[model samples]
Structures are given as C-alpha cells and as structure tokens.
Target: MSDQRESIRSNAKYLRNVRPIDPEEICEYVAGNPHPAVVRQQLREEAADLRLIEQDDGTFVPADDEPVSPRRGPVERFPAEYERRLEDLLVERYGPNWEDGASGDLLRSTVRRFKADYLDGRPVEYNDDVAAGYAIYHLPGYYAAIQYALDDLADRGLLDRTLRVLDLGAGVGGPALGLCDYLPDDALLEYHAVEPSAAADVLKDLLAETGRNTHPTIHRTTAEAFDPSEAVSGDGSSDGFDPTAPDDGFDLVLACNVLSELDDPVDVMQSYLETLAPKGTFLAMAPADKNTSVQLREVERELEEERLWDRDAVDFETSAAGDAERYRRGEVTVYGPTVRLWPGETPSDRGWSFDVRPDLDVPAVQRRLDENAPDDGEHAPGEFVNVDVQFSYSQLRLDGRRRIDMALETNEWAKMAEMERHVTERIDLVAAKLSRSLSGGDGNGGRGSGRSNPLFKISDGSEDTDHYAVVTTETALNRPLLEAGYGDVCSFEGILALWNDDEEAYNLVVDEETIVDRIT
Candidate 1:
C-alpha cells in the first residue's frame, strides 16, 4: 500500500509537468513557490508564443510545440498579502483568539452550521455576523477550493475566453482573487459580483485594499434577485452585458459554494447560463461534504437531462495540434476505509470528501494557535494542516459552444461510478467473477478498501470474456459480487497497478476505498 501511494504521488507529479496543455492555460508550466506574479508572466508569454493553429470547428489544437506544455504544480495559490489580510481579520475578530475558548468555538460552530445549511439547500440567508464569522474562519479554504477549481479550468484552457464575469455568492472575493492570480497582469478584465451577504462589501474591499489589479463591480444582491438583463457588458456597449439586449455577453460566470445554499438551484443555474456570451463558461463549486457533493451531482444530471449542457472530464496526456486523448487521463486514486463493509452494495455510503492541501500561511496560522496556547508550547501547524483539502466543482461551456466529444447522451451503466466520482476521475471497469472456490472469506476481503482480490478478474467490456483483461482486488468493484446471491458481473474503477508476487507473477490490482454497484 505504501508503495502504491508513492506511485500515485509520482504520477500526480508527472501530470503537473508533461501534460500537453494550452499556452493560455494559466500557469500550466509553473511550480515551486506558485507565486501569482511569476504565474501571470508565464501565462501571458505562453499565450503570445503559442503557434497553435485553429481547426475549422473553432477549437485550437497543438500545432507543433504540443499545446501540452510542461508545468510544475502544487497549484497556484492566492497572493501572499491576501493571506496576511486574512490573518489580520482573524486576529481582529477575537484578538487572535485572545478570549481563547469563546472565539474559536463560536467560529467553529458557525462553520458547521454554514455547511449544514449549505447541504440542506436553504435560501442562503446569512446575516452580516454569520457571514463575517464564515469569512474569518473559512476564507482560506474557500480560497483554496476556488484556486483548485480555476486550476482545473486553466488546465483545460477554459479561462481563455473569459473577460467580463459575474461571481455569484462571491464571499470575500475568493474566486475573484483566484482570477486575478491567474489572468495576465495587464489583461483587460471587468468583474461583477452579486451576493446577498454584507460580506459582499468585504469582498469588494478585499479586492481594493489587498490590491486586486482588476476592476470589479460588486452588487449586493442574491443570485435569484440579480438580473443579467441589467448587467453591463465588458465593452462600453450596453448590449453585451444585458442578455435580453443581446449584443455579446460576459465570458465567464462562477457560482462557487452558492448552489448548495440556493432555494432553486435548477432555475438559478438556467438563469446563470442565460447570461453567458456565445462561447461563455460557467463553473459551480462546493465543499466535499456528502450532501453538497450529492447536490452537485444532481445539478449535473439536471443540466444534461434538460439537454442544456454536455458534460466533459479533464484531459491529461501528451498530444499535438488536433490530436489529444478524447478525454486524456490516467487511472484513479483510492481513499477512505478499505474492505467491503456494506451489507448492500452502495459506494455512496462511505462518504467521500474533498481532499486539498492549500499552501496556507502556516506560520501565521500557528502564531494564532500559539497565542491561544500556554507559553510552554512549541507548535507545528504543518503537522495538522498539511492534510488534503477536498471540494467538488463542475464546469460547462454554453449549449451552443459545447464540445462535440462530450457525449450528447449519458451512459446509463456508468451512472453509479459517475456519481461516486463527482469530483475526481476514475477508470471505468466491470468486475468479472473468478471461481468461487478460490475465495476464502465471505464479503470481508480483510484487507482495507485499497486492497484488491487476486482471484477476481477485471474486464472493460459488457460481456464476460477474458479476451484482454487484468486481475483486480479492488473492493470497490467486488462489493456487487459480494451482494448478489449469484452473479458474474460487478462494476469497479480506481488507480490501476500491476504487481509481481513472491513467485514473480504479474497480477493486476485496483484500489477500492469506494463501493460500486452491479446492475447486471
């Protein structure tokens, strides 16, 4: 398991580099400090230098240099001063937890309730007090999630079309800050923010006081209350901003952490889409909480069912010009409890959450913790804070501009895997039965979810055939086999590996922290 973990990390490091990415993909070749200024310079230079040609379909493909440029990652972070300002706000709220127990507890409780309300899909009515508390306690995370969301788009070249934008529920300017961090230093950008919370004011001031290079118009309005028809276009022309007037429109609309709180997400989403320009973009992001995760899936389904959107996954591979993996990707990373513990074959019950490790100002955070601790303490915030931060984000190009490669119709058989992997990519697979006699224990593979069974075989096809396949121990695919009274087919998807046992025989294995269903 330790060996496999290392392998996965190495693959991730490779993806940070070698993936053939577009020159406009923000910070695609950056690594190390992940400073915004350095990233900004690289983004501009690469875009200008890209010799890629445009296909008749209007999509730009790698010409000669391979749009897939090398990038060093650990994703770009918000500007350092932003973190300083965040820490200062936290310090002021409670004098750096000067009151100790009271302030910390209050902030924690507010965050919990905020998450719960978000999952419950309420009207998102947070007064100034709760909103402020949320900003102070959770802004760092929001900033992290927003950065990841942008990184995903940037990796896919989704940010190039962006110019005029609207940020729904733009709390403390997390997404706005992310945009400024990636867009070229001199890029002409017009931003409009719509939020009900007075925190909108904080977001406006954060952009101004913290020195956001871009100009943004912050509107204190709810997602439902805000009207795109009243929005002003990027150019001085009034028509582009007003969807009703319809000359041109904003390039991107980002609704981060707002959907889970919306009263009517479907209607709200449609309205947001209505505000886009011809080739505009829309992104929705939420925390890794189970219910919010569920909400994002529901929204994805609704978009497709209505035929208003075509879904696509991120691509990671090397290709030039018009050639890239239709959905270039490699394997999946497993997490959480191992073993098949569920009585019913249900992966959703395991509860997957967003895992992110944002580059936080640890010293500043530790200093705050130290101020609350007894004088005799030597604290290591890095120990506790390096843990993965997770969030779910979904993006869509407008109906008219949607990519043809993205399936117009959804695959019914893969629905379970799709919902389970709402945030991450998984290699689709179907579990083929091995001789039952080879199995020793009842559903308990004994090994954790990461352990795959040697006896069970894996195949990618619908029919049971060993024409071309690998053996897997992935308990995620095994649960369905465990549940059925008698069946030969189950589903599985995860990071794939080929290992040689003591005898030196190669065996294929897929890790399982997740449980998948077998409709067959």
Candidate 2:
C-alpha cells in the first residue's frame, strides 16, 4: 500500500506540468496495480500537498498562479446550489416535508431559543438540531456579510491566488462557502476549519459542494485545543516548526462571529495572529448589535500595534541576551472598514461601527420555513427570513497594508479629536461613512423615526468619542453623504459641528451650506 501511494505521487509529480494527471493512468503505474477508485481517493487526499486542482472529469492539473480579481459589486443572492444542499441536509435529518411537520416546529423553536440566548449573552451549545436551525436562520445573511467584509481585503489586492486559510470556530460553513465563491475558479485554496461540534458534520457536507480547486479539512477540536502547527506540518509533531517561515503559515485567519463567545478572546486572537504569514490577514466579524459590535472593536483595539514574537524562535532562557528582539515576528495593525487615517492617531471611542449592505434575496429554505410557519403568537411574518447583511468587521494585517492608506493633512481638514473647539462652527472635515442613513433605519434600536433627518456614523480614526454626520437639510451639494456607500471616505466643506446632548455624540450637521464630495 505504501509503495502504491509513493508510485502514484511520483507519477503525479512528473505528469502534472506535462499533461492532465489521470488517476486511472496512475493506478496502472502503481506497484500492485491498485484500483482506480483507491487512486482517486489518494489523489483527493493529496491535492493540497501536490498543488493540483482536480478537474470535473476526474483528472488533475496545476492551479493558476494569478491573484483572484476582486468582485466589483454586491452579493445579490445566495447560490441555489448551496440552498439546495442545505435543504438536502435538512431533509436527511428530518424527512422531506421538513418545513411543515414536527421537525419544523423543532427547528423554529431551536432558532428562537439560540437567538434569545445570543441576545441575553448566554452560551448556546451546538447540538445537531441547533446546528440545523442555525443554518436556516443565520446562513444567508452571514454568507453575504462575509463577502462584503472580504471586499475590504480583495479591493486592495491583498487576497492571494494560492491561499491557505484557517477558519476558527467555523460553524455550519457560511463564511467558508462565501469565501469559496468569492475567489475566482482558477485560484487554489487550502482551507482548514476548527469546529468541535455537530456543526463540523454540516460544514463537511457543505464544503464537499465547493469548487474543485478548494481542498478542505475539518479538525474536530476546539479553537484553543487545535494547534495550527499540525495543519502546517501535516503531522501532530511540531519539531523545528517555524510559523514565521514563508509557505509555513496561513495567508488568512478568520474568526467570524465567534470571538464574543470565547472566554478570553483577546488572548486567543493574539495567539492566532502569530500563525499568520508575513503578509497575511486576520479578519474578525460580529453582528451589528451594539454589544457584539463594540466587543469586536475592543478585541481589535487590544491587539492593535502590539508586537508578537515567534515563541519557537525565541530562546526564553537566553532572552536576557537580546534573543527576543532578534526573533520579533510582526506588529498587528488595523487594515480596513475602520481607519487610522492620521499618522499618529487611533480612535479611543466606544467603537460601535458596522457596515450595512443591500439585503440579500431570501433563500428558498428560509422562504419555505417562513411561509409554512405556525400561526402562533410567536411567529412574525419575516421571522425566518435572514437576509439583512449588517455586520462589523476588523481586518488586522501584519504587513501594514490598509484599505485606505491616506494620512489626513490637518491644514486641509479638521481632525475629529479637535471637534470640541469647532462645535457650532462650520468646518471642513474628512471622514469615512461607517454606517448607512440612520434616519429611518433599525440601527437606532426603534428610537428613530422615518421622518427624521438623515444621520450617519462617520469616523476619521482619531476621535476620542463617537462622531456622527447628520444631514439636516439635504441639498444637491450635500447629498453625497446620503449617496455614498458604507466605508466610503467623503470630504465635507462648511459642515457645522455640533454636540448632540440627547444622543451624547458629535453630529456634524450637513445642510445647504455643506458641500459633500465622495473621495473615491
């Protein structure tokens, strides 16, 4: 068996660049003439190691080396293939009419219970039923949100063609599937997911439907217990493993919607950041709710600018002899959505920032569940439809690459930190539009009315307190504040800065006198 495997690998290495390496042909070349099915299984297992992309016709070819082009527009809908796949899983668990029977009631209650637990800041365990319910309730929105967050990296050409990604606490594979579709077909991906729950079973089933170039492995262990060295080395032993070495660490580490669930999120995040490749990105995402969004920023702030050292490279006993400095790994820096536009400034406010994109077209399963829901007091019309894409994400990179890498010149615009002195006075300011119009949005937690002035959260990355831009009287010139997309930087001319005593936030009033222009 060992000789057959080695002979197959040898033939593949020689034939990969020359032509399509067929498993049938390789089987004939093996010492004992192993079955073609066995050869195919072996090829699938070794695809990532060999950098081979399995073709639709069961042949293998070399992966393209070009970086994936960034997607230009919004994700309109979840793919029908994934929707069907999730439905299939639901059917396998609970018969074909899953949305109408007792199974439907079970799933509906499971979703409501978990949602309530999340809102109340309680730990909800992921059992089989809970995992299925989570897929039905949260999958579509999470799928759309991740793609939007990933745009912040892809727009800057930071995403690579050949990628090694580590997804921590990857539940039911929403972000995983989104990422798979986000990359171009020619790009190769080696994905490792750490999920220690029944969700791993669901994740494995969904990942099987991904593109041929995507090779995934699910480590059935907790994030804290899963050692990245095992994935990097392909073995449990980490002898002489250097995480900082090129081609050894993950290119992207994702902790989406999982940090707020951890006991010590900051420490765990710091440990994961150490496993990032020199030019890697660590993206953390959370729900748009105030508590979770603020907690995400708090984690980002705690790890920002802190230099991490490669523990394996540093000799702790010889640390007194300058060993630590010699083994310095990388410094963490915020890479996007949020900004640190000023050179020496960082925002110290309660950073409750999030981006809201167009809601996705509801998936079939969600629609089915919602349409057939019981006519009970608890069921609302749109209760099961999870298509709103509102999320807070922080991209931390070791390479010091920012999505918006402009240093604001104080001579041209007023700093948000100094807004106190300019209160009630018209001033020129440059800031990123962090949120959509809060005028009639649900972002105000039912406090805002539809007829109120157009309000948005804006940040220049130097404010010590929350700063908002309120469009009091929208004219042709000041309409850009309302027109700009989330995270877009805009320059405001002659905007009045006022302290809103009721909201306890600084409101830069944009009126007829204010001229707003989106700075690309």
- In model 1, the Cα lDDT at residue 418 comes to 35
**Model 2: per-residue lDDT, tens digit, 1-520?**
3667768888999999799999889888888888998888888767777777777798988877766677888899988888889999999999999998799998888989999999999998999999999988888888889998888777777888788899999999999999999998777898999999999988998998998788888899988898886674222234455655655778899999999889999999998998898788999999999999999999998899588864445434445565444565656889888888888899999888888888899888998888899897878898988898989999998777788889989899999999999998999999999887777765453225774887888999999988988888889998888889888899999999899787787989898899999995
Residue-wise C-alpha lDDT for candidate 1, range 272-327, written one tens digit per residue = 77566655667777776556765774675465334332223445466666545553
Off by over 4 Å in 2: 24-29, 33-37, 232-244, 310-325, 445-447
Prediction 2 TM-score vs. true? 0.92
Candidate 2 differs from the real structure by a C-alpha RMSD in angstroms, to one decimal, of 2.9
lDDT of each: 0.48, 0.85
Q: Give the poorly placed runs of model 1, Cα more than 4 Å off.
A: 1-71, 76-78, 87-125, 209-213, 233-240, 244-247, 307-388, 399-520
Instruction: Provide the TM-score for each candidate, comma-separated.
Output: 0.54, 0.92
Model 1, residue 392: displacement in angstroms?
A: 0.8
Error of 2 at 78 (Å): 2.2
- lDDT: which candidate is best? 2
